[model samples]
Target chain A: MPSPADKTARPTGFRVALRDARGHLDPHWWLVAPILILVVCLYLLPLGNVLLLSVSDPKPGLDNYERIATASGPLKVLLTTLRLCAITTVISIVLGFCVAFAMAHVRETHQRILVVAVLVPLWISVLIRAFSWLVLLRDQGPVNDWLMQSGAIDQPLALVRNELGVVIGMVHYLIPYAVLPIFAVMRGIDQRLLFASRSLGAGAVTTFLKVYLPLTLPGVFAATVIVFVFGLGFYVTPAILGGGRVVMLAESVSVAILQTVRWGFGAAQSVVLLVLTLVLIGIMAKTVGLKKGFG
Target chain B: MTDESAGQDIRLYGLSKYYGDFRALDDVNLHVAAGEFLTLLGPSGSGKSTLLMALAGFVEPTHGDIFVGGSSITALAPEKRDFGVVFQGYALFPHMTVAGNVGYPLKVRGLGKPEIAAKVRDALDLVQLGHLATRLPKQLSGGQQQRVALARALVFSPKMLLLDEPMGALDKKLRHDLQLELRQLHRRLGRTFVNVTHDQEEAMAMSDRIAIMRAGKIEQLGAPRALYDAPETRFVADFLGKSNFIEGKVTGIDAGIATLDTADGPVVHALGTRPAGIGDSLLLALRPQKLMLGPGPNSRKATVETAIFLGTHAEVSLRCASGLALALNLGIENAQALPAEGTTVELGWDPAATVAVRPD
Candidate 1:
């Protein structure tokens, strides 16, 4: 057989150089190439175009950003989006924790059923879910009708077409996303540590507070990041349930581009949202230090 | 390092546990003396660990009560029992420093910070891990982790220390060293220790009294020497060490001595407390070390099939003319004089060296 040096000496071209580079790389890198190509074309290209349009679409340099900084309407929209996202993240995390804890400790059959209950909503169309929430929370809906008829209220309550309806719809959509990452981490915790804690003279509440709670912090952190980031970009459920009354940033961006034909302002708002999301994530990662957060 | 008061005595009265239809612990009654080391020895799934868990108040007994210092504690929760347990895998908290882990029990008891710190130091020093107090459990080696576990368990100075195969995860040399350290610790503290293990040599090395369990019951409980020298059943004899079982029929009983008629010849032996009748079958448990490989009154001709030379002694497998196989443990000097394999030799033993045991 010819030696490796002899075989390499016979090939000298771009193809050979590519082959040589491939030999030095891990074989698993090849499996990732297709997804990498798709992400660059479908995600990165559109994102880069939006960034360029933010500065160059209309009369150039800093006009849209100046409007974002000084205009009261845009500032109010930004504050409302941040407030709604925070509320949705906190509510989703609390509800998701209880569900994931139940799923982790219940019998195997019950756990399977609970997992399906959490995941089945994901398979349903988001539009259909938003419409169902709209019907349920309307003025003449079943909840308001029952409350008025039962003497619990003197008048039909305004449950939909408002901020409350938008939050309700957003939290409902964000819960399954919160549950998956938290459940994954919670299941990996070693159970023997709990028994050891009890045997060392810790009561049930104390054991949970001292041992069980600390071990599940990594899971809680991951779930918070997921739910908060998803809540920031939420548009469909809020749009349907708000009934055009509660306007979030995503809706404002669409109105600027489609109704008003202000492409630079819409693209500038998109760039601001992206930058804000990244800055928030960067702050959290610095505070927790990703290695410690995952542990 | 805490005050070494005499530990409390524990007693179990007809303790039993049933998991659906399978009995994990069946009617176990035992007494643990104050300041004694008692070991439960058995094979896997023989309920040794189950019995330990029942004692620790984790597995509630179905049909009985446990008493510590003459007060029934059967209904008490595990935290109320005040017993420290070292689990099989050590189970040290991976997130806590060594000092933090050791100070946890005291912290839960509402002690002041300075006192907790002082006690934690003493406890770690007791296990000779004082210098490693700042290290997390994941940063330590396996043996160091085990010591940290021991220190954490002993920090509160519990009434009794319970260990479930504490050294089962260590390699052989580390296991031996830890066994010695545990023995020394038990002696120094003078606290009641209940340990569970399947290794016979470990049980023999560390236990003041051993309870050999089989099928969820204590088959025999006694001092280690007594159980080894005079086991009451074939299972006990075989489990504790090597033994040769000789089957024969009783032919005569005269003056407390019974003569057994074997296929090779008649053998005379002093009858133990177990009753036997003429013409009834009897089983005898004879230790391999008790048989001599030379001419004597109880001598029998045998052919050596295989001889294994160990440094201290040699084990020779022999077969008699009656087709009974016997093992002879010869000393180094006597082994040097042994003929080659397939050579015929004489094996003998004193009548008092063999004991009658239940067949099963």
Candidate 2:
């Protein structure tokens, strides 16, 4: 028989469980809880609701998902989206790596200028940046003007209002994101390690390959993921620069939702995009592990 | 790995390093024999580490040439120079297992998988870390981490070995243990080692010869006992170890020994090598152990200011009328019956005990 005080007090087992839970949860749950809840409320819940609406509309059936699987238009849009993002990720990562390497090795004054040049565009409106690229890369724009004036070409090359213009604009926008991560990793890399490698009998190129490249692989992976994921959801850049001729998934989804009023179909397309992004992230996380990939 | 007998002689010619207007090293010249353990010992700002870095090809000298085996290697990169370096921080790659860290050079050299594994095993065994090859650097204690670093540095038998305060981060006892191990390893390998350390005792214990540096220049370079007995300047005397400076004026010179009139009283002392003139100011560096801590014919009366009982010996600080504070060590037997504090005591030294050095 337990005493009155013992009966009223929390059980030892339950108390221990509570303490263990608090120990695990206290650090992140308090600080990150608000943001996590916000993501659930604003992002996850809406996405989940879209999933439900895609299947449950009119009747609980798989019609919307069937459209995704069988419909040529959605399938085409998905393929185009993947192809464009792949190309953009490749271009952005290569260019960003060069720019980041230059930034890391340059004089402090030059580095400041380069940093501002990359980051200042990020703070500007994305729509405005896309418009600015249109203004620059259009057939009669400054680039073609210079090319024609320099007698490099007899006429303006096809530079704008197509996949080319869309890619150019997207790469321009994604360059900053790609550059920042690669640069951060490049900066953290022990410069001595490179010297150490070279001193140990490796030539410049070999040292770069063995030491610099492997060390910066994590950063490259991160940049690729960021550029690819961001490219998947991009709307404004594609709309303004692709000139309504090129059809990316976001544009197709918009048409399905707003023009055709196929809300279920649009939701299914969005769900597919989100799932694809998650799948890619999961693969990256699996291969590199979370720590190195995010480092 | 090449046999230790193939080690090359290292020579540096007029090596100098400067950071804009600040000179970190100036006109440094040094020669290390094929299998000698030479140490560059100095205080923090004395350019000892810089000299080691210059030789290792990690720090490019602003001017001068370095040669290995009589061939100029001024343009050789550190790795290409084939010199092993144990960095001051140990610099074990935290991501690597102990075996992985030790096997890096061989791996980089594109050794076959089986060869690499065998070499890694051999290297770990050399450092007595074969059982702990799977452990990461972070899992090991500081002393163990340092041993792993040593194993990594010695994994490939390089042309020479450079250590920059390799045991600086260890505790005294650990440092002592590792110092003996290093000395033994050096003997076994028979490869020239250029070690940089600020700890004079460590330098004295391990170096075949020690180069004492001050203000970006070597003040004295000689055998450890030679340096201890015959320092060239006051700075070299003070920096190497503890010394009681007795400023005096040379009163006479006879039979290659200088008699000086010291402030503590008249003292006749031998000038080991250099000769001094009459009325010239002479500075004598008296080692604490040299002074006798009792009444003698050549003794000066001193008041016992403080006494500290060191484990092996007792250090007694005495103040004389000349306001010179002197430290004298008393062995345990003598320390057992030490004069009480505030009591007057007589301290003296033999004529050959003190070294006459030029004030810098």
Q: How well does chain B match by TM-score in each candidate? A: 0.95, 0.96
B71-117: candidate 2 lDDT, tens digit per residue: 99888767678888888778766566888778888888888889989
Q: What would the per-residue lDDT of candidate 1 be over residues B1-360, giving only the tens digit for each residue?
A: 334556888999999999999988999999999889999999998899999999888898889989998899999998888888998888898779999999988998999999999999999999999999999999998899999999998999898999999889889899899999999999998899999999998999999999999988999999999999889999999999989888889999997788899888988777867678899888888889889987875789999999988888899999999999998898888877766899999889888888898889
How many steric overlaps are in each model, in order? Answer: 0, 5
Winning model by TM-score = 1
Candidate 1 residue lDDT tens string, A1-295: 7556655553433333434433554445577799999999999999999988989979779889888888999988888888998998899988998998999999999999999999999998888988888888898899998998999998878888888998888888889877876787778778878878888889999998899888887778877876777777777877888888777888889999999999999999999888888876776587655554343
Query: Candidate 1: where are CA atoms >4 Å away?
Result: A1-32, A276-295, B1-4, B253-257, B261-270, B273-275, B291-350
Error of 1 at A144 (Å): 2.0
lDDT of 1: 0.87
- lDDT (0 to 1) per candidate: 0.87, 0.84
- DockQ (C-alpha based) per candidate is 0.64, 0.34
The 10-residue segment with the lowest total lDDT in model 1 chain B = B1-10
Worst ten in a row by lDDT for model 1 chain A: A13-22
lDDT at B143, model 2? 91
C-alpha DockQ for predicted model 1:
0.64
The best candidate by DockQ is 1
- Tens digit per residue, CA lDDT, model 2, A46-118: 9889999788864688888887778897777788788889999999999999999999999999999999999
